[model samples]
Target: MKIGVLALQGAFYEHRKMIEQLGAECIEIRQLSDLTSNRFDGLMLPGGESTVQGKLLAELGITEPLRNLINAGTPVLATCAGLILLAEEIEGGEKPYLGTLPVAVKRNAFGRQLGSFEYTGSVGDLKDFKMTFIRAPIITAGHSDEVQTTAVFEDKIVAVKYRNQIGLAFHPELDQDTRIHEEFLELCKSFSLNK
Candidate 1:
């Protein structure tokens, strides 16, 4: 299946490489007008500065289109700052999120970028995956009925799945494991088939 990576900013190129390595067509989306239904089977919002990314989305007038895409059952895999963008609410900031997932987020909860570290945890479909957090946010809690935690760090939920949306608080692409990407592809397949 084809996957679209929001290339607005941050480490989106790395996500593109990872997806392409899995033999899937990867499309780099720079603007809202590039968001066409036929271009990809799923979308990946990469890790970046949430405040900047949020402003960029609003400036480009893509907030509603993206929300509509999620509403229409399009699979979305968001990481790090992308995770913040997917939250229903964000603490310590006024930036509004996409509110696609039933969870709250706190940006830079793990300390500054220099305080980043590598942590290993188990997820729902995959276990013992190594995750790297660079100024990552934390998924404090989620709705019991809709949450499927893939991993956690220091007792805080770091990775979760709500419906077709997968939110991760670390940079999985920066690591050697492909399980997360594979899981995302599987979610995309399920979403495309309307499962």
Candidate 2:
């Protein structure tokens, strides 16, 4: 399977490495041409500044096409700021970016860089996985019946899934575990089969 990693900013390389380790082709999506020229079985939006990534996606004319792909059921695994980008609404009145996922998020809910932390949490049926949070956002509420909470930490919703889209408030790429990434690949495989 081929996976596209949004490389405009943040931790794209780490994600690419992880995906490659799983024997998938990893494409770094840096420019508008990358989106048009390549076919991706899945997409990974890595942790970064949500505002900056949003602005760059629009400026590079990659926003709509990427959104269309997501809407068309391309499996996406979004992490940290990527979660904020997929959120339909932001706490404290921030403009929504892609709004592909059906969750309302609270940005930096864990605070700033100094507030970054690591926690072992239960992710769906998987338990005791290491979650690394770096200026993460928490899903305060889910707005769609299709949306399901996948993981929780400190009573806060940290991971959610809506159809083929999965959003995590922590960086699984930074951790030693590959369950989340493997699960995402399974989603991609399922989407490919259905298509």
Candidate 3:
């Protein structure tokens, strides 16, 4: 399967490495032309500055197209700032970006970079998953019924899934564990076959 990792900002290369390590083709999506040249089976939006990524997505003319892909059933795995991008509503009045996932998010819910920490807990069906948070954002409690929360930290929601989109407040790519990547690829493969 071919996976596209948005390279406009953030820890995109790490996601690329994980995708390749999991035996899938990885494509770095840096421009609109890149999407035209590739029919990505899946996508990865890595952690970074949400503001900068949102700006770049607009300036690069990729915002709508990418959102269309996600909405059209192209599975996406969005992490941290990426999670903020996909959120339908962002708390504190930050304008939503893609709005493909049916959820609300709170940016930097765990403070700033210094507030970052690691947690090993259940993510979806993956038991004992290692979650690395860096300037993370949390999926707020009140969201649409379509959103199925998959992971939580303390008493706060950290991850959720809606349709073909998987949004996480932690950086699964930063950790050494391959379970999340493996699961994503399987999801992509399943989607590909059905298409």
Candidate 4:
């Protein structure tokens, strides 16, 4: 399967490497042509500055097409700031970017860079995986019918799934464990087969 990693900024390279290690073709999407010219089975929106990424997507003419693909049920794995982008609502009245996932997220809910930390937690049925949070967001609430909380930390929602899309408040790409990536690939495979 082929996966596109939004390479405008942040941890995109890590996501690309993880996807490639999982035996899939990884494409780095940096410009408008990358999105328009390539066909991908899935897309990875890596952890980055949500505002900057949002602005770049629009400036590069990628926002609408990418949003359309996501809304069309293309599988996606979004982490950290990517989670903020996918949220339908953001805390403190910030405008959502993609707004594909039916969840409300609060940016930097875990505090700033100084508040960054790591913990071993379970993601859905996946257990004891290390999760790293760096200025992460938290899913404060979700649309019960459309979203399911898959993981939690300290009573805070850290991961959620809506259809083929998964939004993680922690960075799974920063760890050695590949289970999360594997799960995403599985989603991509299922999506491909169904398509």
Off by over 4 Å in 1: none
lDDT accuracy of residue 84 in candidate 3? 92
Kindly list the per-residue Cα lDDT of model 1 for residues 84-147, writing each as its tens digit. Answer: 8889878765656688888888778889979899877677757778889999899876855778
TM-score of 3: 0.98
lDDT of 3 by residue, 67-155 (tens): 88998899999999899999989998878999888788998898988998999999989999999998889887546787898999998
Residue 190, model 4: Cα distance from true site in angstroms: 1.3
Query: Clashes in model 4: which pairs?
Result: none
Error of 1 at 141 (Å): 2.6
Q: What is the lDDT of residue 44 in candidate 4?
A: 95
Using lDDT, rank the candidates from best to worst.
Answer: 2, 4, 3, 1
Q: Candidate 1, residue 153: CA error in Å?
A: 1.2
lDDT of 2 by residue, 8-72 (tens): 99999999999999999999998989988998899999999999999999999998899999999
Residue 122 displacement (Å), model 3: 0.5
Task: Give candidate 4's whole-model lDDT.
Answer: 0.91
lDDT of each: 0.85, 0.92, 0.91, 0.91
